[model samples]
Target chain A: MARASLREDIVNAAVEQFHMFGFTAAGVKDITDAAGAPKGSFYNHFESKEALAVIALERYGATRGLAALGDTSVPPLARLRWHFEALRDENLAYGFSRGCLIGDLATEIADHSEVVRKAVQDSMQQWCDALSGTIAEAQQAGEVTKALEADTIARFVLSAWEGALVSARSDKSAKSFEAFFTVVFGVVLR
Target chain B: MARASLREDIVNAAVEQFHMFGFTAAGVKDITDAAGAPKGSFYNHFESKEALAVIALERYGATRGLAALGDTSVPPLARLRWHFEALRDENLAYGFSRGCLIGDLATEIADHSEVVRKAVQDSMQQWCDALSGTIAEAQQAGEVTKALEADTIARFVLSAWEGALVSARSDKSAKSFEAFFTVVFGVVLR
Candidate 1:
């Protein structure tokens, strides 16, 4: 029981550390320190930092609250807005110090680590799929324009949000988020 | 003359190093070695890696071909497409190994380094200003929708391109770029 608990703790700490400091900057020692475990014990649970990072990306994707996009209880457009609004609020709550972990990993370490690259790709595909499904529903209901493919819009929206996070992190302001909302919701989807 | 040339070499190499390996993962030795200069000579030209990064960002911004946006000879929308096409082609030529230096630095080191944060903000603002000008011209020529403000569209487009680069790097393909072009040019801008 203790061994399994320690492993879980390491994974949790890794998610936090990788999100905050990025994959290359954060070390096993930092993760273990945050987990209150011995640094040497990191090897017992994971084969390498690369392995741990893949797990961290998976945890991040799972916790991203993406299921809200498919709730079907609310209007599709409203559900989409709520989803991004929740993300924007989270960034603001953290003072914009933490950008999206998937984006951070994709930009910083994806080129170097094939495993990490695949993990980020999988996460992106999953996100694109979720957004695409919601968008198609919206299109069918005439809430969104059918002038373009839902999948294309989904991937573009994902990119815009990712880019907005990067801008928000740099400017430490809500200006980028505002731009994203105004253009994406006000114009593109409409 | 040698000293001046070495300083330029270091700045150029720092830009390449930061873009390829990122800020935290890259070090002074790597930049100096790439510049073919002695590692000890790094401090003689720049106060710290952070300072070098600011100068490198300036160099990157200056070379981004933003001036093309203001050239009145061609149609504004055509100029805009050409700018992004050049960037996309560059990414493909490099095998998508190097993402945008500004986006990479903005995500990786902007929060930790105030100087770099300002530099990245400046680069973003510069890019935004250039795009906003071109977009406004496109709107004036009836080439783009004027429903959303030009600056908002500009910032959103910037974010989308940055996000697309992140996607392209992770997927090692042009699909993200294709989505970006399709949505921005085919739908949003239209």
Candidate 2:
């Protein structure tokens, strides 16, 4: 493969492993093995494991945001639900063995590593911004109630969604995801 | 100090360092130094670092939950607010340098280590149960609305609180905590 494609492959593989096992636990060997790249190529592409994390986070953020945004054919509310549903399905497919990459990284490295922390933070903000913008559109379309501002609603939705993920990982069930959707979406649509 | 007291001190100190740093980043030396115990004594009290983490999590969970529960003089709603307020104060005091130990460990080890994952999950559930019971009491007393079920409300509250911590750590601001509380409490009360 080309150098750029090989580099991208490494990040994508690393992101998956990081989501499943966190940055520290998921080593360079695991990432390279998954990427189908030789060990030396990992070093050639990134300065170090931390550097790989930075790139992986950036790519993970962009891919997640784009995936959420690209489902444009669905209604705003359905699109929002779809975003979470996709996450839930993916989690279950993995046997609830994974959490959000950003959430995992934020918990693991936020206090200790400034570079990784910023990457995780920026990714979360981008997700929040995307959700907020969609909610704003829903507001304009009169699909959601006007009792709360979109930004505030966005924060609530995002935070609750993440909280539900934590619960899902712990409970080993997607029930938290379902309940979160039921309550928040129920309130929003009402 | 007696052996039991020394063990407690070691676990307490370990809790602080683990919360400020993380599992992999916080070393045995840090914990021993913080505890003012001999470095060699770490293995004496606990089988390994992982063993000590389980003890520390249990202690941290009990200490934090009891501290929150002991404030019976405050109204239930205010009691919940006080808990978050304390968290806000902690974040500010520590320069937004730490999130909850359980939260950090859940993210870091949930996928990789079943022992740590269960400890973190159990602690979170206990916290959620306590908060939920408090909210239910508040509803019965007409201190808060019954618009949503107490369990659902409690989950949302806890989740938002944890998510806010992550945001606060990332942004290096207590504003996220304040904003989250304002929005969540405002919504619940309304």
* Best of the candidates, TM-score: 1
Q: How would you encode candidate 2's per-residue C-alpha lDDT over B1-190 as one tens digit per residue? A: 4566888888889898888778887899999999988999888778988888888889888766546643667788887777777767867898887777877777676766787878877888888888888888788879887877888877767776777777777767765675577566776633
In candidate 2 chain B, what residue range of length 10 has the lowest lDDT sum? B63-72
Most accurate candidate by DockQ: 1
Could you tell me how far off, in angstroms, the CA of residue B84 lies in candidate 2 after the best superposition?
A: 1.6
- Candidate 1: tens digits of C-alpha lDDT, residues A1-190: 3576999999999999988888888989999999999998989889999999999999999977789999999999998899899999999999988799999999998999999999999999999999999999999999999988999889889989999999999899999999999888987787
lDDT of 1 by residue, B1-190 (tens): 4576999999999989998899987899999999999999999889999999999999999988999989999999999999999999999999988889999999998878899999999999999999999999999999998888899889889999999999898899898899999988987787
Docking class of 1: high
What's the TM-score of each model vs. the native?
Answer: 0.97, 0.90
What DockQ does candidate 1 have relative to the true complex? 0.84
The per-model DockQ list reads: 0.84, 0.53
